[model samples]
Target: MSLGSRSSRRHHRALQHRAIALVVLASVLVACVFHNGASNGSPGSIPSDLEPGDVVHPSPIPGSTDQTIELARTKIKHIVFVIKENRTFDTLFGRFPGADGVTQGTTCDGKTVPLLRAPDRVGDQLHSFFDGITDINGGKMDCFAQGGYVQYLPQDIPHYWAYARRYTLADRFFSSIYGPTGIEHLWTFASQSDHFIDHERPGQFGSASREFCDDPLETALAFRSMARQEQERIYQAEDEGAQGLAQIRASLTSRWPCFDVKVLPDLLQQRGISWKDYRGENPFVQPLRMVRHVRFSSMYRNVVDVSEFMRDVKARKLPAVSWLTPSFKLSDHPPTSICAGENWFVTEMNGLMRSPYWSSTAVILTWDDFGGFYDHVPPPHVDLYGLGPRVPAIVISPWARSGFIDHDTMEFASVLRFIETIFDLPPLTSRDANTNDMLNAFDFTGRPRPPLLMRPRTCPAR
Candidate 1:
C-alpha cells in the first residue's frame, strides 16, 4: 500500500510541473515578439488592429535614413523657428484657403456662432490646463464660445495672411501639447514637459476660466498679478552662483517638479551644429527662463537677446538653428492688437530674406497653443501630455513648395524631426521619431525659388 501511494503522488507532481513549464514557454514567446518588433527599429505600431480613437501616427511623408540626411546636407542650411503665444488655427486663419478651418462653432449651450466673422478684438479667455480639458470634452469638438470664442480676420493680421498666400500653410498642424504658454514653450525646445501641466500658475487651475467669464476687468488685474509672481519665480536664482543656485534648485525641484532632460539644442551641440535661442521679453515670455535645461546648460550663454538675431543675420553669422521669441505686445496674445504681431513678423522675415541666408533658409512660423479659441476638429488621445487644438503653421523657404497646403497630421515635434533628419542627428524621443518632418511641404528635387517679398498692411501704433 505504501509503494503504490508514493508512485501516484509522484505522477501528480510531474503533471503540475509540466503545466507550469508550458505557461512559462508561452509568456517567453510573447516577450520575444514584442522585443523583436522594438529591436527592428520600425516606426509606430500597426494601425489596422487598433480601434478608431486609438491611432498610431507614423511619418506622413516617407524617406529612407540616407535620403533624409542627403536632403539636409545638400539643400537646406538654416532652419528658423518662431514661437508665438496662445492662438488657434480657426481663430487666426479659419478663412484660409485649403485648410480644415471652422466657419461655424457649436457653443457649450448647444447654440452655434459664426466663428469666421469675429469681433475686431476679442477679450482674453482662460487657456489653462483645466480650461483645455473642459473645452475638449472628450473630443466632442463642442463648447468653443463657452470656453472663449474668437476668430480673426485678414484685416487684423494682414502680414500673416499674406505670408500664407505666398508660401506653404499647414492647416492640420497641432500644438503637440494641450497646455498653456509655459508648457507649450517647453515643447518648443524639449519634445516633452515635466509632470506639471500648467506653466507655473499652479493656483489658477480651476478658477482661471470661471473668473475670466464672471468679471473680465477683475480677471485682467488678477492675470497681471499672477504674471508678476511667475516672472519672480522664474528668475529667483538668475544671479546666484553655481553652488548657491544648485541649493536653491534642490528646494525648487521639490516644490516645483522641474524635471531635467535633453532638448534640441543639446543634439545640435553634440553633432557639432551651432544654434541659438533668442529671448526677447520678461521672464514670463522668455524661452531661456521658462525651462530648466536652458537655465542650467552651458548653452544658456547662447541665449542672447532678440536684438542679436538681427545683428547676426546682417553679419551672415546666423547659426544652423534658431528660435525667436516675441514680446507680449507682438505675440498677439489676447487683449493685444494682432497688428503689432503682424508687423513685427513681416519686418523680421523680410530682414532674413534680404540676407544671403534666405536662399538656404527655412522659416517656420507657428503659434504656441490654441489660446482658448474655437476649432471644429477634435484632437486625438495620444498620451498623457497631449496633441492639443489646431494652430496655424507656415513653411517659408526656397525648398518649400509654393502655394501648397499640407493636410497631413502633424504636431510641434514634426519640426524637431525635420531638424534632426537634416542635421543627421539621432532622435530625442519616440514622439519626434514618429513625426512626418513636413517633408511634403518641401521639394529638394525641384529648382530653388527666389524669396517672396512681404509688407505690413499698415504700421501698428505702438
Candidate 2:
C-alpha cells in the first residue's frame, strides 16, 4: 500500500469514531430530561394523582385515609389554586351541558322566572344569611326570584366555559360560607374562622361593620391591609341595611371566641413539602395570614408577589402547592370587567401549559362566593356556618377527566381535602374532614392528557 493511501484511511477511521461518540451522547441527553420528571412507568397503574400505575380514587371521601395517601404521593408535583370573585352556579353555569342546572324556577308568588342571560353586570342579588332564609322562604326556594335572577350563556364567559368544557367541572360545588367575601375567604383558608363572627353590626364592635376590616394591624402591612380594608368596606357596604343584614348580624354576634386553627399549608411544611401563596393586592390570603400558627411559622415566607410565581414557574422553582389571587381589576368582582378576569386566568394557565412543569401540575379555578345572584338547589345544610350557594369550579390537570361533570356535592374546603389527600397532610378542620375531595374528576391510571392551550376570547385587540 502507498503512504498517502494509509494516511487517508487512518483519518477516516478517527472521524467515524468521533461521530459514534456524538450519537451516544445525544441519546443520553434525551433520557436525562425525562428521567428526572414524573410519570407512571405503566398505563394501567396510574393513580388519581396524575401518575400512571395506581388506580386509587382521585378525590377520596373524608376519613378514607389510605386512598388519599395513595393519590397524594403521586406524580402531581404542584397544585395551583386560582380564586376569582363573586358568582353563582346557576347564574354562571345554569346551562352547562350535563350538569345540575335550573330545570325550573318557581317564584314566591307562584310564578316562573326563566333562567335567562344576565346583563354585562347584574347588580348584587341577595346572598346574605337573611337572604338565604328569605330566599328559601321556609324551603320554598323563592328568594332567588326576588333577589336577582340572571344566567350567563356560553358567549358571556367564552374562555371560562371553554376551559370548563375541556377540563373537569364540579357542578355541585358551593361556597364555604354564604354572603360576601370577608368571612367566606376565611372559610376558604381554614374552613372556619378564628374570630367570633357577627354578620350584623355588633353593639360592642360598633355599628360600623368596617371597623375590624383591617387585618389586625400586625398582619396589615405584611399582607397589604389597606386593600383588605377597602374590600371589607365593599362587602359591608353591599350588604349593609340590605335584604338580609339581620341574619348576617346574628351569625356574626354568635361566633365569638374565634378559635385560631391549623391550615392545610402548615401541614405541607410539616411534611417538608414546598408551598406558596401569590397574594398581590387581593384580600383572600389576608385571613390566612392572621392565623397565629400560620403567621408565626415559615408559612409567612410563602406569601410573595404574583410576579414571583411566574418567575418560579419559568425557572422551575415552583413549590408543591400555590395559591394565585389576582387583584380587584383582574378579579370578577362586580363592576370589574369579567373580560379582564378571563384574560388574567388565560394568561396564567397558558404560561403553565407552555412550561415543562405543566405535565406534573393541577390548577383549580373557582369563584369565592355567589355574589348575590340566584342558585336553585337549596344548599345542603352542613352546619351553622354553611355550605352556601352553589358556585362553579374547574379542575385543570393532565389527569383530569375530559368533558366530565362531577356531581359530587362539595364546598371550598373540599380543595383542602384534595390537598391533604395528595400530600398526605392532615385535614385542617371538620368541614373538610367529611366532605368529598373531587375523587371522580381525575383518573391517574390513564395516559396523561395533553395540555389545553387556547387563548382567551376576551383578549384585548392587538
| Most lDDT-accurate candidate | 1
Score each candidate by Cα lDDT: 0.66, 0.63
* Per-residue lDDT of candidate 1, residues 51-78 (tens digit): 1121234333444456755875688999
Candidate 2 residue-wise lDDT, 214-327, digit = tens: 334211101111233343332332232244444334323232222356666767777998888887675333555555666666667887887788899889899988888888
Q: Against the correct fold, how does model 2 do in TM-score?
A: 0.73
Poorest 10 consecutive residues of model 1 by lDDT? 46-55
Error of 2 at 75 (Å): 2.8
